[model samples]
Target: MSETLEQRAAPAPDGPEQVRAAPIGAPVEGSADEQLPTPTRRANPFRRALAGATEVLGPWARVVWAAAQPVVAVVSGLGWVVLGIGFLATLAGFILGWSELVFLGFVPLAAILVSIAFLFGRSTFRISIHLNPSRVTVGERAIGQVLITNPGSRATTPTRLEVPVGFGLAEFALPAIPKDGEHEELFAVPTNRRAVIPAGPAVSVRGDQLGLLRREVRWTEPVELFVHPETTRLHPTAAGLIRDLEGLVTKTITNNDISFHALRGYVAGDDRRYIHWKSSAKTGQLMVRQFEETRRSQLTMVMTSDSRYYGDADEFELAVSLTASIATQVIIDQVPISVVTDRLALRTHTVTSFLDDTCRLQLAEGTFDTPRTFARETTKRLPAPSVVIIVAGSQLEAQEYRGIQRLFGPDVNVFGIRVERGARASIKDVAGMNVMTVGALSDLSKVMSRAL
Candidate 1:
């Protein structure tokens, strides 16, 4: 017998059947044989054509781009603008029969064509750059010489050589060079500040006076001129503050050390080697030799690069100078020293390399926490140091200075130098750290002597 449509569609009474509504735009659950309506839209003819064309012409477009790179490189921005204007003007003049527009366009077109002539000759001269005494202290004179030699048999045309000295460019005009002829030109570099200045890979530039076209041929590698921070010579005793072969004695008592303090009753974990037999016999108990804890003198110098701590550039420079002076003395004394900034560590194996790294030191926005936290995190990765020197600008608050002192243990001697221009040099104890304030580089030695 055939059942009615309503009866067939009704749910069975197996358990009160539940019906759930499907979300909008979601597919509804149905039998495998069920058919669903799907709306269809026709593809746009323009997009289809574009896709086909892009697929077919992609390789050819890349080939054209590769071919046009050199032409685009040689033409200056102004030259391209002029070329575009000339083409547009010429086209409009012919269409509207205007002779004035045609003549105006022809003038720029002719100028560009003639300007290309300057770039026609190849640069055949061998060029080199020499910086005498590549590294110098601040305020010292640095001389850089460019040597251009005509290595070919034929005489070369006149060209201008451009050498990039720091942020400025130095141009040298060359006369026509005969075969095997050499030309030398000297220029002075400004070393008024401590920095690492890059001076040239000398490039021969061929360009028109109007700057419509330019071609450059690089000849030599760039050389770095390190203008190191001016460091003051410290007294021999200054090294004593940072270096100690026999180690510095602290008040903390320990079972085993070189500096003998007293005899104490032995603890459970005490080493037997430190047990004093004579003291044990007299006291009738296990007594060990107590020592005034001695620590190997390893200096850690931390220079803060955070710009917020500095009142001015001079203060930062003074801080750097003071740090360099102290670190340099330690290096010369052959002491184990580690110099670091908030950002990274500086190489302090040799005086030259150390100063060169300092030349690259720059003030940057800090990403870490306070100076104390930064020093703690930085020094933990290195060997435990007995002496930690914190170099910062005067803007650092007194509270921050105390926080740094508290970061180290009682045994470690912490020193802080706050550089403030025009301020009298003075030293005071803050939270067990000897903090010194200095106005100039010369004040460093005096304050350091008193602080130690």
Candidate 2:
């Protein structure tokens, strides 16, 4: 063989010149056991000391901080501002020997003492609250009644009552109640939208006319007023795709089932009991029976309440109304239905309860996986239904529909409704899943009629 220039220039493998020809950075082969160990950097002593100190004093320091939190809160408000100014003025007046400044400072000091005394007095009146029809629909009225009773033998002095409703407070002044007497106050419940309004832990606030020394006494328990989403009439015939209990028999064949489907030529290994004797005699061959496949028509509604799934709060409200309309119509149809909304599986015992749950449902933070994935997993654990309807926000794109399609096999029918505000309503098939968009609540029935 002819020696190439490159080969001639290469170092000899088994020669004494090889060691001397090795490059400065060239690696020397060694057995795994003989290899040098990697070096580790030393940790700083200061960091170690800091970690040790944290471990020792962390719990006690937390306890002391927690103990001082209430004190800090009490002095953190405007009360502290007034108290600080008064203290500084009093000190300066004493130092300067100014009688007018001293008198001025003493006035504030006296006011502080009186305010403290006012805040410290024990509240004598007992309060109880009652909500008429605690759950109501939007545009409906709910009355909240507050009863103040004097439980003690002695007469109860009149005081101001403060009840928080939504973002505002309703105030009332009570008259002096004789021994064992009671007084009642009624307030209107605001129903601007679907919400859970905290009626009260009736707070009685006592503050000086100067807006100093404000104190609150909680006399009643807090109650929730659920305002359900308003729903329009959505015909069940248009909304439901399959009939409940006994739906149309599928063309697919099953070996042994309840419904009598069809008859075919018997194979050698076919079950002998299923053979139709009359048809065999007429055809002069063994005929086997085939039963039509039928499934109990059940509806599953998966609603997404994650804020990230919606373009805005209005979109979410539209989604909720759409869900409520369909679900309400399904319940009216007397079909088995399951409603799942972001992490909450609503109880479907009654239409009213389900509506209540929808009313109380709030937008939740998004999870690591999308809402569709969560719905798919939840559906898998449930008994497979004949129809699956997903009510998602308009934020879902065609790609998400592809992901959602993998959850159900071809045997079941799946429908998707994307709700948007002020958008045109339309329906089309996306990745084998029937999808529709609803712009308004009333448009749902029309859209479903076209889609179904």
Candidate 3:
């Protein structure tokens, strides 16, 4: 800039030449207002948000770390202290005399080397997590993925990676993280009701260069694994009769056409029994009846919400699993099934067909508030005759079952199923309904067989 520009820019002792200036304490004429700029925060779109959590250690990692920290500390201390002493001796020799400089230098050098080793070891440590199924049904198994990854740079031997399952934790040592990636990891995912599997927290453990510092990074990608409910097959074994509620099978009963849905145009290879002659004669169009097997009686599937009877932890999980399993069987068997719950509306439609996954999740959670209310409203809307099947946890009392049964006609056949904790169960009487008790999901088929 030239002197002329500098002089032009300087404020003069005298006011602007002949310009009308605004009076003091008065608004200035035509003065533009400007706002100050503020810094904006950038959000991470890739990394998941840290929800209600403290510290990076995952639930599984915490358990393992708690147990292994003392051992690791002891080993790490012994190894590094010797190196530190060696380093101090080498430094002293370097300052005093040149004798044994190489040998003395080995001390401090060893200390630095040890620290670096620890740091690197901490960086290279691997953590493994196992999730049963990548895909699982809702309210069933939410086990997402088993993860094993490095959190350190240097090699880490005897590194512990323990992950929690249910309430207990399992520990394992991950192989050193090579330049490549985490080693072979396997997990067996359980069956799920929904279509997506839940994702668990990721584990990253890094050892310091000298194997001194250890950093564990926990990453949770909140994911839900979805798995469709398995199609139910109710095979009945009786004194003289054998029957699977599903599939095409005729049963001797008062109502042969009770399960028939609607008539369709007869085509090639049509069953002669399905032909509706009167309707064909009336419209001069060939029509046939689509007959589905009728269930024994009107059904209501009560999925319980009360956690007390369901208990805490996996017990509640088992109860929910039973509910979905029964729901699946009922729909597949062409049973006129209405799901009843304690609070809020989950799913209440008759399951003569497959209900979508959203409805299944709702049913498991027992979000549907009142069975009596839903039954009353459903009765007014749908006039179809149906039986009642109480697919619920053992926690619900017989009175609730009886109250639900009374909503339909007096002849409505109601069957209650009691869910057990594990793989063993015995039947118990609930009101007038025949209650079939079962342990584990494998026992559900047995209960359905009795229902048939």
Candidate 4:
């Protein structure tokens, strides 16, 4: 006989099918239409009571935490561990009736209490951080001064001040200062590499000798020290890369432009303003003027910051210096320029701002790994350029250079600068693009002059 849908779906009562046990308080897995057996186990009473108490004491716990924040900030990590041990030992000693553990615990507890007294006083002083010549080239000496003046009427107490200089910290011991007296601390920052290093927001630290607790008070705001790449000075004219008043002329013909090329028969959609009346009268046909297209001398530079394209840090640094040197000369000439990397675009409004942005450039793995992809993505965001320069390390293959050149039209002048340390500097033509290999920074001017 055929069975009904309900009978087929339901489990047999006398079959070998075993019911799996679900976790306590978890819903049993079964069809909603069918009534399932309830779970026999109940939740533990202790856990249920603890949860209820936690819900009732939530507000009180928050209040306690808020009050303890100051103490928590001042207490060091070691202080917390010692405090915990002290309390646990004291409690265990009372329960076990052992005097030795109680005495051992009292030592740390007493020391922590005594350490709190060291952080009692306040610091009131005017502080200022001054970096002499806040911008410097790599391997140059960058000096900074911290001036602290006691503005209060009474004498100031002795304290220790910590000034964070890049990755290192500088500490100074300030003696007692009379009213209206000033103290000066000088420090030198290491500028071995190109980077944007933060100098200070000088902080005064008060702590005991036991290393239990510390209180820090910030006095001054932090300032950035720009360690720019060492760049060479290119020629003022950039080897005919920039035309003074008139823009770069291209072979593309346009109906209206500054440079006239030839005359042609008027098309259907020709502009009426460009019609050559004299030529039309002689030829007995509607003739229009055609002119060669001219684009404003806009230079767009793209540098690859991908680590995979660089052999070492020196090669990347050389590439940066080469890019900066060329871009700086262009900026000095007041030409329209845009400098970009695989990661971000740099500001090119002024020479100082341009070099300052280069100080923060770093090599990393990015979305556009190859020159072709980097150029393809970058060209969309910029305007049509008369000159395009691609800067990269020596690790960039020859095929990649050809791929980059194909992205732009024949009208756009494409140049590639490949930086390779300790290699001979030379310029070669790669698929109609001028590819220059630069070994050292001093060779940039000679190579650029030859290439351009």
Candidate 3 segments whose C-alpha is farther than 4 A from its true place: 1-182, 185-200, 207-214, 217-233, 236-300, 307-325, 333-385, 392-397, 409-413, 418-452
How many clashing residue pairs appear in each of the predictions shown?
Answer: 0, 0, 75, 0
C-alpha displacement of 363 in model 4, angstroms?
1.2
Clashing pairs in 1: none
Two-way lDDT contest, 2 vs 4, winner: 4
Residues 58-93, model 2: lDDT tens digits: 887557656754443333245565676788888899
lDDT comparing candidate 2 with the true structure: 0.69
TM-score per prediction, in order, is: 0.81, 0.76, 0.38, 0.81
Report the alpha-carbon TM-score of model 3 versus the true structure.
0.38
> Which has the greatest lDDT?
4
> Which digits, one per residue and each the tens of the lDDT, describe model 4 over residues 358-440?
88788878667567988889777788888888898888987788898888888888888888998898998887788999999
- Candidate 2 clashing pairs, residues 3+ apart or interchain: none
Which residue pairs of candidate 4 clash? none
TM-score (C-alpha) between model 4 and the true structure: 0.81
lDDT of 1 by residue, 1-452 (tens): 11111000112234212222222233323211101112111123433443466567898865765676577667776777788789989889999999999998898899899999988888688988788789999867667777888999899888877666554455666888889988877766656678777767788889898977888788988887788888999876666788778998989887678999988888898899988999899889999888888888899888888998999877888888999999998999888899989876999889999998888777778757677778788887888788888889988987787787777777888888888999998987776568899998888888888877
Q: Tens-digit lDDT track for model 3 on 37-141? A: 121111222112221131375787667666755444333434455555677777777788766864866855555555545434334434344444443333343
Cα deviation of 181 in candidate 3 (Å)? 6.4
Candidate 3 — what's its lDDT?
0.46
In model 4, the worst 10-residue window by lDDT is: 1-10
Among all windows of 10 consecutive residues in model 1, the one with the lowest summed lDDT is: 1-10
